[model samples]
Target: MMPPTSSAPHSAGSAGALLTDARLGKKPAPRLRRYYLEPGLRKELPKLHQILAVDLAHVVMLAERGIIPATQAARLVDALRDLRADPEARLRIEPERGSMVLQIEAHLTNAVGESDAGALSTGRSRIDQGATVRRLYERNGTLAVLDRLVALQDALLALAARHSRTLMPGYTHLQPSQPWVFGHYLLGFANKIHRAFVRMLEAYHHLNLSPLGTVGGSGSPWPLDRRRTAALLGFAGLVENARLGRDIQYLADIAAAACLIMNEINDLATDLQLWSSNEFALVELDAGYCGTSSIFPQKKNPIALEGIRTAAAQSMHWFSNVLALCRGMGSGDLAMRSPGHVDAVFETTADMTDLMTGIIETLIVHPSRMGARAQLGWTTASSLADLLVHQGTLSYRQAHHAVGAFVRHCVENDVAVTDATAGLFASVTGLDMALTDAEFRSALDPATFIAACTSQGGAAPEQVDALLRAAAADREADRSWLDTEQHRLASCNAELDRAAEILAAARPAGSHHHPDLAHE
Candidate 1:
């Protein structure tokens, strides 16, 4: 299925046409309304209804405060509830109405007189409405991204647990540098994703503030209770600075968090792509995640991973677009409120996170091939140097030089480090000391190399196990955060529903008019 569109309500062609016709003294071109304007409204209608609900709650608050007459507020609330209850039957926007708000106002004016219907927008503007909707959209989107990230982290931790001692070749500059287990490698990704999750939560905290009371980048003339509206909307607090409430800098925070996530996915994809190649032959993707080439029957392409890589790149482009759109725009400019651009970034980043999670969860590892490759690259040379240092036979630098020379001699003589003789090491180190067969084997053993790395954040099995346990705890914390935010949003929506119901009940039944409004 296609992802959701922006939360900003589109301008209705009818509203635009009526205004333009009044100013120009002629019917506006039908093509613009039919092709450009109408289609946009139709696409945005679903999310626009959500913004309408928020507006209704604001109107109810106005009534309670005596800012608008209680009778008028009841009529407006009833109409709003009727429209919201059966949006397909009651909410309509023709080329004569310009927006969802205008459409609603027109309906209410026709249903309960112009004075009562018009009062619904007493302390609100399309500008602040748009900003508020975007925040709601972002708040929802951030939670979604976090949910996927938490799942991805869990998947990684599970995979890492099973492969704690599954030795693999760790690389530097695309060349094998040392021996490490698959578990340790996966833990690295888990740690990175954990950091991304934390950053997203930070961004979520910032975006959850309400901009409802800051109508048109300034406080409304009426004494609107910003805090009450914010509480009703599930926002943590007001944006405080009315002017700053409309700024698009929050989009930058979102973009930064998304970029961090996609970049991590890109790195993981690169590694998987390399490992799945014939040259590496270290991993086998599940058939569910792979595709066969149309022209080559033997080809089992990692198409899913390739798509993830491409999605990561696309997210970067979308992030750049958001940055550019908000770069020079004023706080309340239309450019600062480009919901479509910002939504694209969120959608793409979330897509990649889900895709990568699937890849990690299902991909098959080749432990034998990984171990064989790990042993082929003289990956234990550093271990030998360490052994030399620990034995008090030579300083670290001297041991490093000795091991370097010994590796070159083995390479030149077509001898594997595991098969080299004691005489060979002595010749290279220019020492008269004798080395035992057990010592030679231990020095070249991948398992020995991995076990010896017992530093705080090392590849040793014990260290990896510790890291894995810590990551599980971190994942639990992230899940708890997601749950808390979800409950907050749901409770806010429930509160709004209750408030609307109360206002609607104040009016007598059947007092409002019903029209066969088109669902535009």
Candidate 2:
């Protein structure tokens, strides 16, 4: 539906009139329904429960405030509950009607007649109700994504814990650069994803505020207790500005967080995709996550990672679209504020995270292969440079140049890193190799390089263990947030159900005493 035309509620039997008098005297064109109204209805199907919850809470609040008679409120509440109970049977989007409230009115008219059903929007407009529903629905999407992210992080942390000392070649500009620990790499992802999780959770707090009572960007004539509806709907607080309540920046924040999440997923998935390839063979996806190429007999493709990358790229496009649509919109710019498929992006993001978590949990690592590759790339050259600075009485830059020259000499002479000697190093760099044979070999050892990296956030086993503990704590905190929010929302829903049932039962006529009314 749309905003109410005036402060007054529409007449009883003329259902859908609230959206009708948009200064357009005629009904929406049939073409409009096909292009716009039809798809909007299908989108609302997933949001049907949220729509009813908002209406139920509003009607109960009206009853609690004595705005409508107790008997009428009882019927209205019961009718809404009925619609909620069997929505598939009771609700349908008529092309001509083109409004959820209208459908509700038709069903309510059947149950309680139109006169009482007309009071359903007593102190509110459909616009405010829609804003409220959007918030609730998006809250659910946010939590769904967060739940998956937490599980993904937990899986990453578990893998990191097991492979604390596993060695690999770290890359710079896609070229092998240094010795790296797999556990440290995974922890980096854990930390990165947690940042986006924080952004989403923060946005959720702003998103949780109630916009229900901000009817048409202004308060209505009735003494509508906004707080009562907020409580029933599980809002943390009111969206204090009635106008600003209609739209908020949290939608963009959520979109941005989703983009960041997908971007992180893209990077990780790209790495996994590469690692699982025939050339790298550092890791392999489980058979369940792989797909056999129909045309190629021997190919077991890393299809899950490919799917994640595809979804993530789409999310970036959606993120850019959200920004494009949201820019230059006013506070009440309903047309563009809820512009596009932010919800779809959220669904896709959560799905990909779930997919990644499965991939990580069932992954098969080839440590021997990873270590063999790590040792072959002269990845320990930097460690030798550090040793030169310490023992060769050379400056750090001088040492870097010397090591660079040695690497070039080894490449030109077809000599492996293990074949380097003091005479060979001296011949290459024209400098004395102050480090003895044992010291030089230790410096070139990939394991020794990683072990010596004792700085915080380093590849050293102890450092990685510290990061693993931090990651565990971070994950625990994230889990606590998810659990607490789920419980809060669940308990609020139960209370709403209980209150609706309480108000729906038969009550004494002309006796407005309801248990939900605040104590004087």
Winning model by TM-score: 2
241, model 2: CA deviation in Å?
A: 0.7
lDDT on C-alpha atoms for all candidate structures:
0.78, 0.80
Worst 10 residues of 2 by lDDT: 511-520
User: In candidate 1, what residue range of length 10 has the lowest lDDT sum?
Assistant: 1-10
lDDT by residue (tens digit), candidate 1, 468-518: 999999999999988887897789889888887787777776676444233
- What TM-score do all the candidates reach, one by one? 0.91, 0.92
Q: List, residue by residue over 353-372, the lDDT tens digit for candidate 2.
A: 99999999999999889899
- Residue 366 accuracy (lDDT) in model 2: 90
